[model samples]
Structures are given as structure tokens and as C-alpha cells.
Target: MMDMQTQPVRSQSRPVVEHGFVTESMTDTCAIVANLEHCTNTAVALQSHYAQGFLSSRHKHGRGQISYCQSGMMLVMTDEGTIIVPPGHFIWIPPNMYHQAQAQDGMCMLSIYVENGLWPDLPGNSEVFHASDLFECLMQRMIEIEEKGAFSSSTFDAIVTLIRDEIGLASRLDMSMPMPRDRRLARICNAILREPTVLRGKDELARIGNVSHRTMTRLFQTELKMTYSEWCQQALILNALARLAAGDPVTTVAMDLGYVSPSAFSAMFRRRVGCSPKEFAKQY
Candidate 1:
């Protein structure tokens, strides 16, 4: 999981400090620590407006990336799987991993790129991390530093070290929505994904691809290693998480997602997320 701290922010073109020592409890007393003259080991950047419908061509970087979105969501697609990063979550991408990004709405993002040898014990694959309050604060502070092209400082190194340690032991969630590359299965999968709540069941869904229900079911199992029902469940849950992040009421979201009743949806949500939908939505 990701984590965050802080208070009223002090606005300024450049962060100025009294003694250059930072505090976690009060933002007025804190400054977005200036960066290092040379961040060769961990280059950082920020995208304040990941605009609606944002899309990136497939690409790879030589450095590992740690990305956090303080608002909205990010969809990442790679050979291994597809990852959904909603508000209050973070995403990590290993160096040289070919991937593309899609955003349905605007997002505020902070990305730190670590030189290969400086990655430490972080995972080698992309991870969608649940951002904690502490990490949220840190990301904001980090972003402030990255915005200016020339704000380097010694304390910046210390901050990077803390970020590395925090990620090493943070909680992990099985939040990926893996997809098959097969043309036929991909077509059906995309249809259901467009409107996750309107699925007509496996038997009828097979018609989208002009295939027999049995064949479609087998194809899902073989290519994605997940049954059709399992895939649907995964899609629905991902949609629910996004809606909750947008501040939708639990009851309304449940009903809109086609749950028979709020209680039934709550049970499934709790089983899958280990918390009530109400509790989950409060993260933002």
C-alpha cells in the first residue's frame, strides 16, 4: 500500500525555508525540498494535467518509474497484464518494460524514475499500489520540487531514500485485470469492459465474437487462465473501485453496477476488498 502527512500549504514561485529543515506536521513550516544538481540516480517529473482521454504510444524507459496519481485514474497496458490506478493509488513500472497509458479523465501525477542500479529491492514489474495518507503528502511535496527545473538541494537525497524504504514494505493488492491477446476473445472482452454492468452472461456474450459459448469459455480459460465468470467479476470490481473514488454513494454505485441489492453488493465487495464499499471510498 502507499501512505502520506501535513497542513495549510504556502504558495510561492520557489520554496524558501528559514533554516532548510522540513517538518511533517505543518506545510507552512515545510518547503518542497529543492532537488539535487544531478538526479542521475532518480530523475523525477510531474504531469499536473493527465487530460481526459489521454493516451500514450507503447514505449519503454531505461529507468524504473514510480508513478502516483493524487486524483483521477490511470490505465496501464503491458504484455503481462492491464493495471488500473485510480485516485489515491500509485503505480510502479520496471525499467525497460514496454507499456502504454490511457486516462479516462484528468489526473495529477508525480513520477520518479530511478536509475537501474538505484532501484534497490523494489518489484521488477508494474504494481498498482494503494496510496496511504503519508505517501500522499510525500508525493505532493515531491511534485512541488519537480515543477521547477532548477531547485536542487541536499535534503532531496534524503527524501528519495525515505520513498525507497516506504515502497519496499508497503501492502500489495491483487488489482490487475489481465486480458487475452487473441483477436476473438479480446473483442468480447472489450465489449463487456465498455459497460461492465450490462453483461448478458457467458452464453449470450459469445455471440459478439460469432463463437459458441463453450468455445468462448474454453478460450478464456486457456488464454487468460480465468473463467468467463471470473473475468466478469474482475471487471465489475475494477469499475466499482473507480466509481467509489469519484465520490459516488455506495448504494447508488451498487445499484448502477447491477447488483440485486445493496447488501448483496456489499458482501461481494467486502469479500473481494476486505472492506465495505463505504470504507474504501473514504481513501480519497
Candidate 2:
């Protein structure tokens, strides 16, 4: 992904609405929208956030949101699942759907929040849509409009309608992670999250959860719907992707992430991400 710290800034127009807040320059690769108030259906606010590390908060927007990164990668988590947004790939979040997004590398994002009732055909709540050619262009246009602060007669409505239609027709891609609420299982989850690439075996997690191996297995399958090892793999892959995006070298990342060797990590990367680490790095 291109560095946000060096991306061209939007025009000098200041925000007219007191309700919308913007973080003009977040980093060399990202921006942030702290919050926006009273910004309802007809109008949506666009902002950006860039970070080199993870963002831990799970969010539920009052309206729908689309986060398209100009650079780097984003992993968005929701109750339903987690979606990986690579550069040129974005995620569409329906209204009221809880989600948390973490930066894999340093990321530059353009996020738009729409009113709840604007589009009916689209999923009522969370749906992750792959970024299509038209979809990507529309997002770029939105940036141009917002930066110029030039709202014409049909500007807002036209843009919203196009986005709504795109949402209606856009393919729903699998880019989500399911979250379990069980506190016992959650303990194991927390441990894995803290050291995703290093943790090993169900016994380790069972010890931390203070449960038998059998119990831990049952809880992991029943609550998380995946084995402990599988969950750990998923977590490690996500962490690896983030680290890779942040411009880390493969050999160093492999070592730091607990791989036995760079080749071992490369194989895992290819298996999970459908590409070698070097190939994936080129997309950013």
C-alpha cells in the first residue's frame, strides 16, 4: 500500500458541519474519523484512519459503512465473521452490525458512513462486498467531492443512490470472523490473541482455561465452531498479513512470528493467503 504520510491531501476546504470530525493526517499511510454527530440518512461523512498496529475496539455503526483502503490491508471482525480487505479490496458493513477493524500494515483508508434506512435491498445489517471496478471508482469520486466540499443539486442523492445500487448488486464475499462470548473459551481466545503465532496445542489453552482437554475441545468447537488449532492458524495468518503489510521483511517476520523457518512461514502464507509473501506484498 502507498504510504499515507505522503499521499496528496484533499483541497483546503474546511468542514462546514460541526457534527463531523476529521483527522486530517493520521500517519504516512492512514487517517481517522474520531466521530460524527447528527449526521443522518441523506448525508454521510467520509474520513480516514491510518495505523501500523491493531485497533482493538469492536464497532457497531448506527448506519452502514464502507471502508476502502487506498494502501495496505485491513481485517474487519464482526459477530458473523472477519473480512480481510487488501489494497483495492474493501468491505461493506450494513447498519447496526458490530465490527472491529485492525490494520495489518500501515493503512490508508477512506470510510463513508450512510444513514440506516437508505438502502433496503442490501442486507439489513452486515454484509462484506468485494470492491469492484465501479465500486472503487465511486469511492474515489466521493473523496474528490468531500475534499472539495462542493455539494451540487444531485450530488449527495446521486452518490448515495449509486452506492445503494452497488450494495444491492455487489457480491457478498466471505471476509468475516465469528466471535464467541463464553468467558472460559474467551480466556483461551485472549491468550491466542496475545501470542497468536507462538501458542501451541489444546493442552496449553486448556491449562489457561483451567479445563480438561476434553472440555476445552468441546468448548472450542461448540462456541467458536472451529478447533483450537484452526483458530490459532487463522489468528496467526491475520497477524502475519498485518505484519507483512507494515513493510516487514519475510525472514524477520517469520522469526518474530514463531515460524520454525522462513520457508515454513512462506508455505503457511501461500496456503492461507493463496500467494507467497512476496507476491502479496506487491499488491500494496
TM-score of each: 0.76, 0.72
| Model 1: per-residue Cα lDDT over 1-284, one tens digit each | 01001112223344222222222211111122222113443555443355555665567767677878777777788897778876666888888788876664566666666667687577777887766677777766665665453355565676777777677656666667888888889889888887888848776778887889889989999999998888888899888987887788989989998887999999998777657888777756
The model with the greatest lDDT is 1
Model 2, stretches more than 4 Å misplaced? 1-37, 53-59, 75-84, 98-105, 124-127, 165-173, 249-276
Backbone clashes under 3 angstroms, per model:
14, 21
Which candidate number would show the highest TM-score if scored against the true structure?
A: 1
In terms of TM-score, how similar is model 1 to the real structure? 0.76
Note each model's CA RMSD in angstroms. 8.7, 6.2
In angstroms, how far off is 114's CA in candidate 1? 0.7
Q: Write the per-residue lDDT of candidate 2 for residues 1-284, one digit (tens) a residue.
A: 12213333233444334223233444222222234334433546465655565464555656667777778787676776566777766677887676666666567777677666665555654555656678777867766765676656477577667866776676665444455688887787777776776747778778988989999889878987887777777777767776777677999889987888999999988766656898767776
